[model samples]
Target chain A: MKTIKKVALTALAAAGFGAVPGLFGLPGSLLAPGFAATPGSAMAQECGTITLGAALSLTGKYSTNGLHTKNGYEFAIRKIKEAGGVKVGGKCYNFKVIYYDDESTPARGAQLAERLINQDKVQYMLGPYSSGLTKAIAPVTEKYKIPMVEAEGASRSLFNKGYKYLFAVLSTSEQYLASAVTLAAEVAEKRQGKKPSDVRIALVVENDPFSLDIRAGVKEDAAKYGMKIVIDDRMPRDLSDVSATLTKVKALKPDVLIASGHSKGAATLTRQVGEMKIDVPMIAITHCESADIIGKFGKTAEGFLCSTQWAETLSYKDPLFGSAADFNREFKAAYDMYKNRSVPYQAAQAAAAIYVFKDAFERAGSLDKEKVRDALAATDLMTFYGPIKFSPAGNNIAKPMVLRQVQNGQYNVVAPSKFASHKLIWPRKVQ
Target chain B: MFGLCDFFAQTCGNLSILFAAPVFNVQLLIDGVLVGAVFALSAYGLALVWGVMNVKNLAQGDFVMVGGYLTWWLTQTFGVSPWVLLAGLVASFALLWGLGWLLYRLVIAKVIDRDLFTSLLATFGIAIVIAQVLNLIFGSDTQSVDPGYESLTLLGGAVTVAPQKLFAFLLAALLAAVVITFMKRSRMGQAIRATAQDPRAARVLGIDTDRVYAFTYSLNAAICGAAGALIVMIWVIQPFYGITYSIRAFVIVTAAGFGNLPGVIASGLGLGIFEQFGGFVLGAEFQQAIVVGVLVFVLLIRQIQQAMNRQVVQ
Candidate 1:
């Protein structure tokens, strides 16, 4: 008891150092994780090849997405190497992919992206499979003026800042969940055989910028169609049993439910709805595209129509179909061996951005940062998965979200009259 | 009606409305209870070291993390399920036990008669070094080894069990019970109890008190290791995950007074339920903050209570 008493008192002194004051700021950003690997310091060993930096997670909570983005990046790397690498005015720059493990920490990722650009001084950079990390390192890329073609980050604010350095291949934030909102609205609109005078909608989102953006975009679009957002409050990611939030949601009794969050969070909310037996027709934010919910919760994720810039299988029938087929094939081959969740969006686009960078540099006829930035900003090329284009603000809003639903426990592209590669299924009956 | 009244007061809404759907709140409470059991079981080890070992093991959390990764690797590499992995967990804990013994005998044993500041620094260093190594070996991936057991819903609401987590809860309780029973019933346990009460006297009585100390230290570590393995079955496991778990264990262990396993278990369940309520009412970002805050608050109260009790006795 005396020993325990003495030890218990230690917390008082240590409480002074435990002050976590605004960890979101740039100062905490610089208090870097010490495990960072030196690039040109040692990586110069493998010389005579053009170096590009990739800081991606292959493991961690975000590993599912990280691994997928790594695959996408690797896929592009393979394609780049096979084509004799980047062609700057027909002179091939044999690019060496300098990959590092960021481990999904925001501060660590910011420090690492800084190291990659400043130390090794790689002319170009790629990756990061999480929006949290991407937000951390976005300033670093902008500071250096290195045009990073983003394959996976979906924090719509990345473009809101008018940073020309970062270009994303993924969809805008949860607020811009065009496919999900449009699908829910159109189906209900058509079901009523006319546009309803009052389309009551409720917004349930995770407390993250990614989810916030999707929620915002959904509201923006809803207002455009004269729909009212009934409920808008951000819940925590770990708040799994959504009964309290959903009860409020059910009471508001919105005509449509626009749920936005990470895949696991999305799975929890969707599954809880099933468990609680709530029967409001729903649409998922972008995270609905991943295979975790379909795999873990199985069919509970079915009928959750979602808005995504990419899907796993596209019919190749639609002219504007996001490259879900190409992504699905390459992702399965690279993944599947690791018994983890399905591919995350961050992994997919971060990988594709490498090829986009290659194409941009080749088109510019120079490796100059300004020229490549211009080349990337002026990009109008079709990628393996989607028709690649970035707005002046560095967002590829051109690739409108392709709505999808879980049919028989698989992602099926279902909506947008032109991109309707498959028919939309509803009311998934749990056996 | 009071549940509703309390709900409305806390939620600042109609308690009747929140209480009408007890499904969500109850489910969160159950999950919390199970999770808290795991936290309490692990925390008892830290409490034991603080109580009997007289040296706070800051590395207790890292041990949980290491033990979790070890179980993950064991299952992934050697085809061991959580049930079958009990033997392996015991062996691994025994290794931790040996390490803790070596650490205690070599370093901490000397510092036992010294100031609290030095022990704190030494243990903190041990924690950082262990955490760094695990980060390197594991490459910082979040892994859930859930064997995809169907979720069981009670009262037909959002409370769910992956079946694996339910088992982990039982494991935590059972292990905690065994430890409690051993302390209460065993001869060595009495000696441990005796030494904890009056170490100088126990030594004078031919207890070979150092051996007793070393044995208790190892036993505590082995228990912690088992708790770590059980945690990974329910939640995602990462290298640094132990740090959070460690803090959680410390919180519950300290709040419970470390004298009773049931108390520790109750406190752990209390924390889980508190966190679940926080998630429900406050928001998720505040979940960790709430846990840490409650822990700090409870510990402060306990320390003050102990200080007051000591002054009164004097």
Candidate 2:
């Protein structure tokens, strides 16, 4: 009886292990095809395939945005294929991305980058999900002299390192909420009849590379105006609560509150600030669209100033994806989950990175790494995302970060006068 | 390090703010006590299992997450009315109890008689599996349920308390009371206490110790599930957020000692208040650091007390 029980338990454990992956809704057979050699079946792939490697955060803390990044890459690849593939040196080649789950860790990202370069022999590379992971993989790719087009890593620190082969499609993090600071100073002077120096700022950001860079930018801008920083707090990584910080905000009565911690931060701030009825005049945060804050928290998310790299309302257009609104419509049609939700800028910028690669491959006219590197460095084109022009430091300098406010459940551009489609709502009323 | 110096300077600055106003202390204390009530609920469950079954279940936090997700998903899929959500909380308790029983039969039952390390490893594996399954089902998003209740403002709006949080705290206190009453008055509870005292002796007395062990673990899981349900309504829940709760449970149980119910409750609330004050003073970045630091401090104090006792014996 004891032996039989032991055998039964072992068999049950094996069955559980086998059924676990199936629970993720990804069949083992489907995953097998992604690892196997490309079958020469499609007419568009008559010439060959250009396999690009990416280490994404398919699990762990950043998995939500990681999935968004992966979908964006897949959507762009499908569109490119439907557009008759990329013609390089008078031959057609379909784009294929070899992906590895970085598990949202820096060490794993670096190791996977090495594996993709050495073991998979993938010459061209795509970026990871977060700034931390991208920071990890960039050094490996740079050491191998592999040209990479990344959409996510936005920390100014990433560009300052002078990586020659690295190219980014998104605006740097320093520009993320700097506009909010300027707007805060303007409101203080115009409405409150106070000098910029009298403006009180409270900053609560996640203690990560991305959000910290945002904090630095806000501080620098605030310092220029001689604004007082009343309560500066760094939110813990697994941020679930911020009542303590909000309590301080109430006590200090800061005129402006700036926060950046990706989606979770946005959600927490919106929910708790509304629940606690924190009566700050202005509140700005990152990742409002990615978090779907207006959809989740409804009226509480109203009057929130969100920073974005791209908005579908913009007039940017291209030959392949057409106008920004067209790309938005087509992407929603492709991904069912995004049907009722606003497509995040993370996905738009990710797709733009792929567009950059396609343009560079065509412009270079050769598969040689050096030629591709120079072509990427000289990238100057317009897509549905924005203009792609690389500075000497490999960061996109052509695009401007726009500030959008959640007005009546719609994200309308409200800042930088050149892009303001809606007026700023002062003294946000919590109902 | 410059960072350390900056931290100290910030902490001092925060301390001065506290002294200058003193009204903010009420806000911090109220927030801490409310948060601590939920922590105490889970810690009580951990204590019950550790004392009764001799098994250290590291998956306590994951159990809470499961409960929270169950409540959140139910509300999302069905209705968000107050009555419906209250039903969801009860359903979470019942469902988690069943899950606990299944886990006991499949994993915990076998490891119950093994060494301490064996149970710890088994539960750790269970934690990973539970967290992963939750991630797959929930898509790794942080979810919460809004109770749509108003907050009470006090001290000229310097301190505001959400009614949902107060409701959660009351529910937690009520549940703890009911569980304590059952443990003291019920026949099964006596058998479980007997088993905890001495399993071999209880077996000799025909107490059906296995049944007692199973019952104790399931009850603990049920308590944790209820706590999770409350947490979802009050704060937030995510798949990976389980480990933090697990760590908190371990800290509370360790500081309270085994089988000490009152000690668990007090220590849980104390830890909550300490975390709030610490986060407020040191900045919120050091909240988790403060938790682990307290664990170390508590252990060190216990060690010194034990050493002094040994010297007295000599």
Candidate 3:
């Protein structure tokens, strides 16, 4: 045990000396005063359940993501059901969701959405787990003119595509990438105490559409900030070898490593970081906060940084968070699983999107799909994540985002001082 | 910056370094070669079985995965260091050997006199059954052994190699060489070879051909077990990933032609370099597509060679 400790100490020193960005260094320890006290949640008398449609991939490649979002949606439904329904404008309407697995295949998602609209006659639609699948079902939703809400497919241009009925819960892909650039600048200021523009960066992706969006977003914004993208190359999606990629990361010795992949593939990444002990810090843009990925590497993900939607350590009980604490508490009591690991932001986003549509329908005062579409287009309501103001087309959003840093396997907000519970954990130490 | 792929190429005029100069190119090669070695090791045992037992082992990869799951369990349960897990592997292999001998007596011997088509389908079914069983036991959570290398650097540029990976590469080469030499020189090796050449002749010469066949299969499985153990030290293992490894192994064996250890090593490394350079020119997203594409390309080449062989025979 003593020897293992000595070796671990020696290894960490050698890795730090290797002159790369440190491992996850953001302090996950600080506690947010949490959500402020809020008035009692509006309760409704059971007024019968109104069904919404979901064309989510329950199985196959995107199943893992779909499953998580489903948990979020279900947790929301459970909350509304427990409270007796949505208390809106003095009328209570129950929320019921109709879900189709879609199996992560594009064709199935399209067919499933069509079935939900026609056969099930669900008033609104929810859930499509991938960009391609979401795009496939977009036309279907538009045809019926039912208000569709999505947590997946953060493609910047999706909601931008002249659609009046589609609303998104999370930030657009471009917004997420912008957050990455933002983190890079903050890292340099806080850790390197140097100009953000001077920081060197490497761009690694899976050579897929999702990753491509990230790379393009970085390149487009990189020069604006004067940050040099020293390395830009993609490893294979099923990358079994990462030595060459890591080697280049070592040689270029960039200030940051940008990686994108599934949870399984991402596991090898942190382990490799521990092994070669490369100095450049890494930040994963998508699916990096996965419990499976982080759990495998443990402290190896310590100093790494990412722009995330939810962390278990957050004080969701704040007034700004609204019913997020209720959702979290209910989810834990029911499932015995923490929110961050099981109920990701997408799930909450999807469920809340449905509620927004329901409220829009109630406000519009009719099920005329087009009227609901107009109501969604004009919505300025507040939800768990804050205001739901959308642009004319409903793509570009005004949702507030908070930065998260990992410390000893926990995550805490490190940016946007109002929401920040802790100091920035930059260039985190592996130990 | 031009990136490290060219960092050394510019200074040393080493043309190969140019292939690895870009970070993307280097990463592609790293994934390919490290994975390629694993594929080679998995396929090596199959080649041995094909050569000695006169039976193509379609169920070979499934055995490799089964061995891997056992190792994963032992290490996870006992807190075994990866290096120390070799003993657990030996014990597991011994058990597998006993199972193999029993299988030979009850099933394989009954089908020994059957045609190729019959044997092939039967073993393929066996592969499906074994894979399903292992998948049930292990689940699909990508298991690996983290030795937590200090990530040493030897002054890298462009295609900078991780010392841990470099060490793994060296380890694969050394292991392959030792296993091949053992098979070539041992008395057991001669007996296995004798049985493969002519079972009737070997039996008449007092060799227990059945025992030889069963023993060779067990040793083949043991080699595969060792490969699995070493593989988790560097790569993550999943139940379904065995198919990719299996296909790559088959492709390398065909490219190198069976029974040539040096040729197999060359072919595996050659694919690794191709993938690395391919990422340089093509996109890395299709690297797996490229691997499968090259596999079909090699198959066509083999088909052409077979046609040429047939013409010569005529």
Candidate 4:
């Protein structure tokens, strides 16, 4: 009888320990104070705090961009505080974000989203780093009726799901590399004096939803120009090498090569292209700034065209962040790690997401989640990142994805004619 | 279902490409063989530990990552010369040897006499701890070191081989030869071999089996460390990338069977070539899937061989 009683007590103790995380969302709340208390103490004291929960990829594959996203959010919050916080319902509230490390996994992302909503009682959420992670957490936020202002997820499929509570400030993934294809066709028509249909494309993309959607976009655009896809390869997720596909590129001699993966994929592709001396006439890839290709690869990355959602040289401005170039300069001054490197679009759009939240909160004039979400849907504002206006589908529709070429170690916007800040370097020279 | 059809179409297209340009076969073969040389080093370490100590170490790849990180940090922090990077290889081996001894004293020594599952669980726990600690120290970015050597292009640049990869293959071979020589000629290696045959008999013959186990495990770690240092120079390493290496080691050892040195080398190279061909024909996405599929196939073949050896009695 005594043994049975002891067994029951032990079981109860074990169960209690297991339930602690679910009950309190221990890591999220424990990390919240340290992350939130860093901005402006005097302003925070004067204004009530509105807590926003974020489940970011703080420790896994996406951690590099995830850290950038986190830094962007924190930087924006600090700026907003210095600008006197968000005024809603005749009261000002400073933003305080509670962070949970999602470890770059979809399952963990969804679980953390639920914990943030149910356990921490957080009504507002900021998105995780990648489209894959955002897809995982969107259903949870939708189920809980919590509004999420996501900056990173650009997958077109994310919008087609008819999610009411999910809002994104970045352009969709399909638009990411479509401009590259269009540029390729334009080069063929103008320079080579050939039909657009004569252009050949080689695509090497990561197998994830984000890169695959980028692939689909490129394919759709390429088909519109009647261009042929010579080599279509899906790189593995943990991409270390893509030499085998590059070998095919050499044999086929495709006119243009478009590659998309996250930062790791970008780094690997850039490194191997240099080592192999792959001489494709034109090469365009995503996440070049995030990967720091110019800093890492130097001469090898000179002619590679990079697709970006935002560039510092753009003539975008707002009362809070001044100009797009101002945001770039001040952000670098605030974060030491970004010294000697350009601020990536991943970080820029993240700060823009926070600006969207502030705009919606001020316009709604209430603390209700549904009202803020409706305001987010109705948002039309120009910020340092870009002009963000959400379509009924909840994606920012006012912005266009720009193509930038690495000329003389600087990322200069060169495509789409209107956004061209520099001449497009045609037939990229081999190092 | 659409994915399956797409894969089939891709396979056919890739096969035709191979037939159309046979020069690519040379490129694939060269890449596979070079990568396999590095894979063999880690698998050889795993085989040594598994054969001598009867302990299945799931932390084999973590030891490699630790070595890679140490070399990368040294290169990045000190801006070391290529010659110093070579010295860093030896330094990593010695450091990892010490680490292996420390781990044996703390955890492995306790689990040595336990059941197989206990050793597996213990080593798995060690793997997680090592990965997490490395992540904390270095962050989760994928890092690699360039050896500053140019590549060799052949067949009108249709086939290119990085000089770093060739150097790594040669170094791996030299290391393997040295380890094989040491195992054959050294008294400690003889004791380890004897213990593997029969631990009780070796104990009766006045061999300190505990010390032999420690030395063997440490030597295995030292080999894996050297291999990892070479890998960082040629390829890339991340905190979470260790598991793929661990899986590759298991595949090589399982296919080769532990204690067979020649078999380990051959099977490692064979697996590498197979993966290259498979990834080339299918997409690079199938590279990991191919490793797992090989493991399952090898395991099934082993099960069948064991079943065949069993005699039914009436």
Top candidate (lDDT): 2
TM-score of 4: 0.90
Query: Cα deviation of A25 in candidate 4 (Å)?
Result: 23
Q: Which ten residues in a row have the lowest lDDT in candidate 2 chain A?
A: A30-39
Candidate 2 on B238-268: residue-level lDDT in tens? 8888887888898899988887788889989
The deviation in Å at residue B266 for candidate 3 is 3.2
Off by over 4 Å in 2: A1-47, B1-13, B311-314
DockQ of each: 0.10, 0.45, 0.25, 0.41
Q: Model 1: per-residue lDDT, tens digit, A94-153?
A: 556677788677888889898888666676778587678878878999998877777767
DockQ of candidate 1 against the true complex: 0.10
- Candidate lDDT scores, in order, read 0.67, 0.88, 0.66, 0.87
Instruction: Answer with 1 or 3, whichever has the higher DockQ.
Output: 3
Query: For model 4, what is the error of residue B202's alpha carbon versus the real structure, in angstroms, after optimal superposition?
Result: 2.2
Query: Per-residue alpha-carbon lDDT of model 3 for A208-270, expressed as tens digits?
Result: 666677677777777778998766767665566555456556556787777665555466666
Error of 2 at B50 (Å): 2.2
TM-score of each model, in listed order: 0.75, 0.90, 0.74, 0.90
C-alpha RMSD of each candidate structure in angstroms:
10.6, 7.0, 15.2, 5.9
As a TM-score, model 2 comes out at: 0.90
lDDT tens readout by residue for model 4, A328-402: 999999999889777877888889999999999999998888889889889999998888988888898899999
